[model samples]
Target: MADTGIPHFCNDLGVTLIEVGSKEFMCIGAKPPFDHPHIFIDLGDDTEHVCPYCSTLYRYNPALAAGEAKPEECVWHDDPEARTAA
Candidate 1:
């Protein structure tokens, strides 16, 4: 996984709307081991987008950092070492 610098998010907390830092990001539905397809979501001109697999709604907040999320736990960090060990 070459880091494209795209932020990743998860809905494991089951929040209604996940406020994210960027309009363009990857939605993992939930955390790994129970996550759906990591779908690339580009809001484009819009401020919101819904994950097609898990129906998780993501809203953009300009005040957030690129990797930040409203609930904080929604921000996902992939573990490359875990993938290698598996």
Candidate 2:
């Protein structure tokens, strides 16, 4: 399910179940794996994951609304113009 296309997080707000190890959603395989404050279901495989802290799902992605440029393609760290020249 992680091979068909791009992975996305469930934008839905509410309490949801997640996998034990993978830390993803329990039922719908329609999202990515949880890595940040929000949990993510595989969306393609229906994996489940739960937060160890507040028992909330967690997920992290740096390319969701990144527009035409991806997080990996960002130049924040390399762009001297965006930084103070010391």
Candidate 3:
């Protein structure tokens, strides 16, 4: 599947909670190679969500910019063109 252009979040560091900017985005259990299936997560009107695969809790914050995460490192960047042809 192609990227949905939404922000991607992860919990590779095993953080208790990840604060995100967008209510709708992807929760890649971790970065690719060691990542689980990228799951689409939508907070809707709620303030928080959890990734079923990794059980990582995510909270939404209006103070953040789209694609931003509290820990910063939780932001997963999927650059298809950067991948080597393998």
Candidate achieving the largest lDDT: 1
Please give each candidate's TM-score.
Answer: 0.88, 0.20, 0.87
Between 1 and 3, whose lDDT is larger? Answer: 1
33 Cα displacement, candidate 2 (Å): 18
Itemize residue pairs with steric clashes in candidate 1: none
Worst 10-residue lDDT window for candidate 3 reads: 77-86
Question: Residue-wise lDDT of candidate 1 within 11-65, one digit each (tens)?
Answer: 9999889999898899988888899878999999999988889988899999998
Evaluate residue 51 in candidate 2 and report its C-alpha lDDT on the 0 to 100 scale: 41
Comparing 1 and 2 on lDDT, the stronger one: 1
Per residue, candidate 3 scores C-alpha lDDT tens digits across 17-63 of 99999999999897778889888998999999888999999999999
| CA lDDT, every model vs. true structure | 0.89, 0.32, 0.88
Which candidate, 1 or 2, would have the higher TM-score against the true structure?
A: 1
By TM-score rank, best first, the candidates go 1, 3, 2
What TM-score would candidate 1 get against the native? 0.88
The Cα RMSD in angstroms, rounded to one decimal, for candidate 1 relative to the true structure is 1.8
